[model samples]
Target: MSEQPHPPKREIFDVPAMTNTDNKGFLRPVDEYRQLPYGLYMSRPADHPRFHHLESWLLPALGLRANIFHFTPDHRSGQRLYLDVGRFTGPDADGRWYSVDWYLDLVDVPGTELELLDVDELFTAHAAGLLTLDEAVEATEIAVRTLRGAAAAGDIQSWLDAQVGGRMPWLDRPVAR
Candidate 1:
């Protein structure tokens, strides 16, 4: 078997001279960063072919980072939300945020399905000694709990709304024409 890859690291710095770095180490200019009660919210332009922009909320309480990809019309994937299970922290003395992906993800299609992804990647990483047993277990638990909560609440949006006390910023944004 091929060796499993290490998890990606993300960082967001508040300094005007600095830019948010993505998993690929690309520095992307952040349009905004809002420190919320539950977590940190970031919006930035994506330098990718599929999506023109990205908005994400790093919810530490949920152990998940939720993303909304502002895809170009021709590249729509029908995915309403993309969630990454991970360890997130931030805004220390310098007001910087950090995230380490745990190799698990959720693809929410809304009213259709909440697909769990990268189970094999999670297991492979654990086997390759890239993640501790405790970390792997925690990541699994977070994914399961999120699925269950979303199911019980009728949808991911409702589940997130309940957790954050209201609608997320992305939810209120006007649809692109």
Candidate 2:
């Protein structure tokens, strides 16, 4: 069997130069695979691991059901604490899915939350071709009026504290199969 070639690493928007305003123009260079619908949301990011674990636990806890997650890139903030947002099935992996929710990383500082962009901007970008119809519809399901929030850090001790019962599940941590 032939080996599968790895996709080339492409540098996207500089990120820091972008602003938080809800402008459709921000959705330029409409590369559907890289920018539209679920494309942007699925990009691999620096904070993906924490978000993955958080999703693993939180989704089931909240009774939300979403096998897929859409973590959109800010591509605007220059700082380490850029705004991160996504959609998922509720806290339970089996529950109804939710979208356009914000995810914050407190980092080393306590009581600090990352700033997030308004959900409408996502839809505006979608309408402008930054996102696909599926992505746009999902954005509509989670409009600006109804936003959600979650927080995490490299260290999960605090994240565990915020859980409904402060319970730690073995599956949340790394395990060998």
Candidate 3:
């Protein structure tokens, strides 16, 4: 019997760090994990101080990223999407903010985009008990709107080209350098 070949590893994510915490996200403690825009993300531990926790990823790859779905306002259609990970907290959880992560691929899902927030932020948000279902919907809706608008105006293909900095079929137009 021949063995099946393994799928190529996705560079989008960095190698997992060795830590006492053994959480790896696919669909996790937070179903909303699938709702944040593209970036690394994690959920809060059962109990921790600060009420929120977030760590940094390896260099270069550090940025806001999310897994989101693209779709119409009514969610009549949907597509899986992502943005590069960006944003982090200071030592004492000073100012809180999220940057405009890069544009991610939008595979067909339903036209209703799901924004997967950065894992670290998700963890922090969940830990702080600041996360809410309504907020998740709003996040996803924002990404969906951005994607739809970019597709209409053609800013995304160029942005996508910049994100990969390589030639890809997804670009409907010739990406400018």
Candidate 4:
């Protein structure tokens, strides 16, 4: 039998870097990554320091109530990245459960500001053959409609709290200096 054709190589989504260094290290929501051509992986390691900083100083200092999900690398370059399927899920404040799973990319970008990388593009790309489709139905079923709807109404934080709920304890664990 003839050898099967290989799938296309994964392309890194070139998320535009912000020129304003003033807010370079802050974690914030980005709408553009939601429509990019590559996958977005959660950067848990990059989030460790900032997450601690947020819990220990920022949020408390400002009297702000917010919940942050896993951090996504927001750097312009460097490091080898890999894509693995993953899922994020939790209950809303009312106890309704919701979840989103997709191709999670992992990269090493020290000192990079971590932001959420939208995975809808991953689903789209997978559907189009730019990305792999290991679980066709599960991959195709990826939907953030409810999440986006709440986000559009400026209630993303509240929704995130309901879904992903509470501070990540791992971020608060003591680390050797």
Query: Cα RMSDs of all predictions?
Result: 3.1, 15.7, 16.0, 16.4
Expressed as tens digits, the lDDT of each residue in 35-153 for candidate 4 is 11111211122334323212111121111112233433553244211212233222234322222224433222333322234355555556667555654344334223333433554
Question: Positional deviation of 42 in candidate 3, in angstroms?
Answer: 17
User: Which candidate tops TM-score?
Assistant: 1
Compared with the true structure, what per-residue lDDT tens digits does model 2 show for residues 1-177?
133322211122322322111122232231111111122211222234333211222232332212122234533222322223344332223222233332211222224443334445554455556566775565444322122333333322333334334433232232243
| Candidate 4: Cα lDDT at 35 | 17
- Model 1 clash tally? 0
Worst lDDT 10-window in candidate 4: 55-64
Q: What is the lDDT of residue 114 in candidate 3?
A: 32
Tens digits of per-residue lDDT, candidate 1, 24-122, equal: 777778887777789988888887899999888999999999999989999998988899999988767877888889989999996686999989889
Q: 1 or 2, which is superior by TM-score?
A: 1
For model 1, what is the C-alpha lDDT against the true structure?
A: 0.84
Worst 10 residues of 1 by lDDT: 168-177
Q: Between candidates 2 and 3, name the one with more favorable lDDT.
A: 3
Best by lDDT: 1
